[model samples]
Target: MAKITNETKRYPTDLTDEEWTLIQPFLPKVARRGCRPQADLREVLNALRYLARSGGGWRMLPHDFPPWQTVYW
Candidate 1:
């Protein structure tokens, strides 16, 4: 498994290495022809977990998360 290098802050809902390894295969591969994604999937997933756990509006997501729109889409 690749090392998670950009994890700036730990969140309760953030997936551990084992969890991410298990779920990684189910996520779609990045498209090579289109513009590359700006954020990592792990970051996106963490943002999602934060949203789900906090029951907060998209616009209210903490700054540590990716932009709310990124996670929403």
Candidate 2:
């Protein structure tokens, strides 16, 4: 897991380390054949949770989360 830099702002919906650990196993594993790197599952989950909790539109998601299209995918 990548160490979160202190510079990265934390969002209200961001999962705690324990929460992420519990859910990490259920997330899909990265395919070895992909040319591009996989997006961080924690960030993706955080984005989804933010959307669910805020009831915000995809375009209106805060800049802190991954791009809306990525989360949508």
Candidate 3:
């Protein structure tokens, strides 16, 4: 039997370049696109990962990321 690490159990959330291309049109967009965009799905997923690793309070997360409450449940 193989011993699975925590990393192995986590969901595969990394979006590939091609995969991102397909989902880009459908995901919500932030205003002011001329300069740069913030809060893409990748970032949100990353934040969720960090929460899982640290086991911290959702509200403790910085406001820049999505509500941890939503991500947890």
Candidate 3 local lDDT, residue 18: 55
- Candidate 3 segments whose C-alpha is farther than 4 A from its true place: 1-38, 67-73
Residue 9 lDDT in model 3? 32
lDDT of 3 by residue, 1-56 (tens): 12224454333444444555665688666666575543346556656766676777
Residue runs of model 2 more than 4 Å from their true location after superposition: 2-9
Highest lDDT model number: 1
Q: Give the candidates in order of TM-score, highest first.
A: 1, 2, 3
* Total clashing pairs in model 3: 0
Candidate 2: C-alpha lDDT? 0.79
Q: How accurate is candidate 3 locally (lDDT)?
A: 0.56
All candidates: TM-score: 0.84, 0.82, 0.37
Q: 1-73 in candidate 2: lDDT tens per residue?
A: 6444435538767787768778889887777785654567788888999999989999998887778998999
Error in Å for residue 2 of model 2: 4.4
Candidate 1: pairs in clash: none
Best by TM-score: 1
